[model samples]
Target chain A: MSEILYRILIQGGSYKVIFNGLLATLRISCFSLIIGTILGALICMLRMSRVKVFKFISSVYILILRGSPVLMLLMLMYYGIFARSSLEAETIAVITFSLNVAAHIAELLRASIDATDYGQVEAARTLGFSAWQAFRLVTLPQVIRIAKPVYQSTTINLIQWTSVVGYVSITDLTRVINNIASRTMQPMITIIIGMLIYLGLAYIIHGIFALSDYLQTRREEAA
Target chain B: MKKFLLVLAILLVTSSAFADDYVGFLSRLKTTPDEFFMMMKNSWSTGGWVILGGDHSSSKARFYDTLTQMQLALNSGEIDEMILPDFVADYLLKINYNYSRCCISSSGKMGLCFGFMKENAALRDKWNEALSSMLNDYSLIGLAYKYVKNIPEDESYDEIYGINRKQLNKEKRIKFEHFKDAPTVKVAVTGDLPPVDFIGEDGLPAGYSVAVLAEIGRRLHVNISIINVNAGARTAALVSGRADIVFWYEINKSLSVQPDVPDEVILSMPYLNWDKFFHVTLSDTE
Candidate 1:
């Protein structure tokens, strides 16, 4: 075991490479999440719209994204979109992941919107607010509140999903672990380390969400 | 109490008979033309499926043989489970194809075949006492070192003598003569092949190529860095001066421009060899 572990770790330099890879992974995932959230909000609005065509299009988009495996989507984006073009792999990964996440996020957001009491929107309408105004002033805020926990959980899933980017040649944490395992021929040790890092990231994200929830509740109490 | 016990024994026998009938159904299912055709179709759709397709009848027969053997082993509890080793399971399964045989071939003196077999929990436990001793005796590092040393170094006819061990050693160990004046020796490899260039869980670059490079770096006392470049971006990486060395290259006989890469791109001696062969046996049907 020690022999295998020795093969994985050198005195200094290798650790730096792994750290850099992790940073690249985090940067890509965060960028994807931000893009995904904005796109998802718009899609969610379309999904809830009175216009049948708009709702149908959004539903189909969601169905396709959810039905297909993320791995296949990543491949399609890399080969289909970027292979013939000038876009780099990292850029392709970001776009693909963002689109994939948007599909999931749109569904979550739509659900949250539906979960809001119909009375709130009706009241806003009675007060002479437009449909958009009702959503913004009365409905959207409650929906955001209700969806925060699910959104946070999805963010964690997105981070883990980012591991697949390595297939497209982006050196994420899992890719690093795979390299180490191959080098050392000590897959067991390398996999354990990778699992721990992922779990650690998940825990940190969960803690942040919890803290945000606590603060929101505290503010409500103060009011 | 005696009557209840007899009734329970009868029920157990009836269930066992039903199980045998179910196994017969599965055995028949394994040989159906439609089922075999579907499996082939699935394999074609998936990239790596090894198509044993010749005659449909023969393919079905082969399938039945494998499935029946597997089922018998399962029912008898001879081998409790079928377990694929990580590398084979992960890499091989990703490609849609049919496998001719489940066991790794032993022709190349590769150690992985045995390692994969040993991954079977029942086999590992059954032979644990003997296998443990054997494993302790087997030094994989020593074997790898021996294998690495045996690769022949290339020499030009212009050389005073064909490159010998002494010259090879000097060439490997010698510092780049232009290193002091030249730009840093940066290397790039595809980041997708983990255990080649990517960093590992230990927070280090631990792939086979990386490990070799790290050794080379230590011996030469040069500051070397491995840049993670995507497969499609390798040419761009070289042209942009982002990397001085491409970590991998394969020789293709059919491609004319294969060897037309940079003159500075020194090809390493091939460290591994692979060969494909078919085992033929005369059969009455043929």
Candidate 2:
């Protein structure tokens, strides 16, 4: 067992490759999550629009993005949509993952926003604020508060989904893990280490969410 | 009315232009075979599709679930041609034969060999000796024609090996060794590959490669256990000491593509040579 551990973690500097892969996964996930959040916020507004055309377009976008598998989406973006484009696979991966995350985030945010008390927006409106002001001051804050936990879960899912970027030849964590396992021919230890790293990432995300939740609660209490 | 007619003409022209673009793209495609199944070379310099690492090489193409899907992609005009080993292409063509849609383009031969750890040099030589014997005795050819050529049973054994059933069994039987310290060898095999290494219907690893390994083990007087693994895990199985040997093809090309692969592994003698590949496409006859 110690020998297996040594083979996985120490032998021939295999950990370096695995670490590089982790960085790739984190890079893709971070960029995709940031872009997706911004795009999703815009999409949420479009979904909530009074105009039928805007709502229809947003619904169709959500349906298409959310309906397909992320791996399929990544493949299409890499091989089909961006096939002739000079863009790198990393760029294509970010775009595909962001679009996919945006669709889900739009729905998640929409549900949270809708679940909030409409009377709060009405109260803000009655205070001589415009519709936009009411939504920003009263509705958006509550939406964020409601959606915070779900957002963390979605972020972790996006991180996991980024593993498939290897299809486009991006050496994300899973691919690197597989590569190490392949080279060492010691799949058990290599894979266990890989899984532990992923699990650690998940725990890190979970802790960050928990910390954010704690801060928000304390701030609300102080208020 | 003229404006409406002009808009309709423009739409028709635009759609047809899109179709033309699709056709043009198909004609220019250079497909590389995906490594999801049987292991082979990725870096043959004959306009074969090479799946490049994430270094963002200009030539890297798409990854398919399998070779058959890649063939389907080729037929449906999604890809122009697949650059796969002659052995794989032939195997695919035989099972999914439609001669009208495809044609074989013979490339130069690739040497197939078993990859071993540097420490297993003695074992490698022993296996090499066994392979040479099989090659000389025409047993290997018989095995190849049986699995690779898909020659009919009953006829292939006698016709290829020139030995009847009883003699063939006798030739395969292991002699008892009284030695207590003979090492048991563990060999890694991907049971997904047919005619080479595959899980038989009876749930045992059975194929030409397995039969060869068995014969080698019999002669060496060592117990050989076949460890089944996913195609991707073959190398890791070797490096991790989970399996001492793996049947590999075109080791030089594989190493060239994946330079990060440790220098510990070495190749045995080339057991088989595959030099022909076919381009499968939709027939223009329709």
Candidate 3:
């Protein structure tokens, strides 16, 4: 009986419930990373800007988002800010996560940019390289190398945090596992399976980052 | 990077200013009954008591957010037994025979009903009217049985709930009134309690309360939207206006207990009541 129950949960069509949930998690994480990258760059510029107002707003944004729990921010965004709106929970999750990632990535970019050796850029300029060329050739590569691991960590944390989206009624991976386990009254094996899947997901993300680093190194050597 | 660290430090310090009592974190952890009683309790519980800090005023029993979590904790030996409503225990034990239920010594009784914000008093009344009509015809009781008594014990659980067996129970999943011209009201359900409140495998709200909501929607002539949420977040969902109505338990006079109901919530006339509590443990414990 236990075997049949486990089989029906995994091999049977009920597994599709878990698969669809994984897809939702992947969609939100990927969307947040893409939008966050763009927004992060903009926010990074504002943080480093000479304009006092923009700098103040950017600092507060970073302080508010980075200092508080992401789950709390997601709830505040969903229930407090957009409470009256007819927006889907998924939409709110994406928007909230994107904003959170933006704050972290912005600070990451600012710190990395600040840490770069300006002497190399000056040397590139002296060699008749334009400002953009100097940044592209001498500074950007260094910044990426310095920021690669932290950025990957931030993105991975964002993915894991998406588990909390179920609080708002969005059926992400964690919620699916809980629903299945609770409904069937078979949580031991179910929880083990869920844990294995999450670990696998984290490994996949880690591998992607490793591959990106390898490719970046290869490009630099080839150049 | 040093300046960045400094800024973060300032933020941390400033956040403490917002807390009225900032004696630091260590002072906040409340310990009770001195060290020896705690030692005995810890020895009794195999370290679970230390985690729970037995007999603490501020904390209650090890609170689990969902039924699954509670079961996991039990299996892990973190908890000995789980206290649950009689029907919920019945539903759980029906699926998994590995678990056993024991009688709990409690006379507390509570009734399940829909809760709305004070501002939505009229909406609450409308639902009450529809509920009365359903009760008058015995359809409400019948609806509760759809997932519980209606499910034949011989059949597979999947087939009963249409998990992997979609072709089965095509008519079993209740469809609510989706009137195009009528105003829509969003109702929140945790789907944590199966056969009573749960989502079907096809990712639609199933079970008794959903069926009741469907019948009420028909009588009220309003479109009903069901939102799935974690059980712990039900009240938050309602109070935030994400759900116009959510499940709220009303403690009966016989129970003589004031439930931890929110001040803003206005409960509807209860549609279902249960007086029994059960202590559930692994079957091996029997």
Candidate achieving the largest TM-score? 3
Computed on C-alpha atoms, the DockQ of candidate 1 is 0.10
Prediction 2 TM-score vs. true: 0.48
| Tens digits of lDDT, candidate 2, A94-206 | 99999999999999999998899999888888899999999888887888889988998999999888877656656677766655443333344566677888889999999
Clashing pairs in 3: none
TM-score of chain B of 1: 0.34
Q: Cα RMSD (Å) between model 2 and the true structure?
A: 17.6
**All candidates' TM-scores?**
0.54, 0.48, 0.82
* Most DockQ-accurate candidate: 3
Q: Best by lDDT, which number?
A: 3
Between 1 and 2, whose lDDT is larger?
2
lDDT per residue for candidate 1 within B1-286, as digits (tens), equals 9999999999989976554211111122113534533443344333422323232222221222122233343334333222222232233222212222232211111111111121234432322333343335653243234333233322232266454645543333322233444334566765333323344443433344554454444435455665654444454454444455564553322223322233334343322222211211111212
Cα lDDT tens digits for candidate 3, B1-286: 9999999999989976553310000000122223322222244333212222122322124546678777877787656667676677788777677787754423434577788999999999989988998889998877766656655432466666555343435656788867988999999888777777776776677787888888888888899988888776777788799999986444443422233356788888888877655667788964
Model 1 residue B153 CA deviation in Å: 23
* Per-residue error (Å), model 2, residue A99: 0.4
Ranking by lDDT: 3, 2, 1
Q: What is the TM-score of chain A, computed separately for every candidate?
A: 0.93, 0.96, 0.92
Model 1 per-residue lDDT at B45: 38
Off by over 4 Å in 3: A1-12, B1-60, B106-108, B151-168, B248-250, B255-257
What fraction of the real A-B contacts shows up in model 1? Answer: 0.19
- Per model, how much of the real contact set is kept? 0.19, 0.00, 0.67
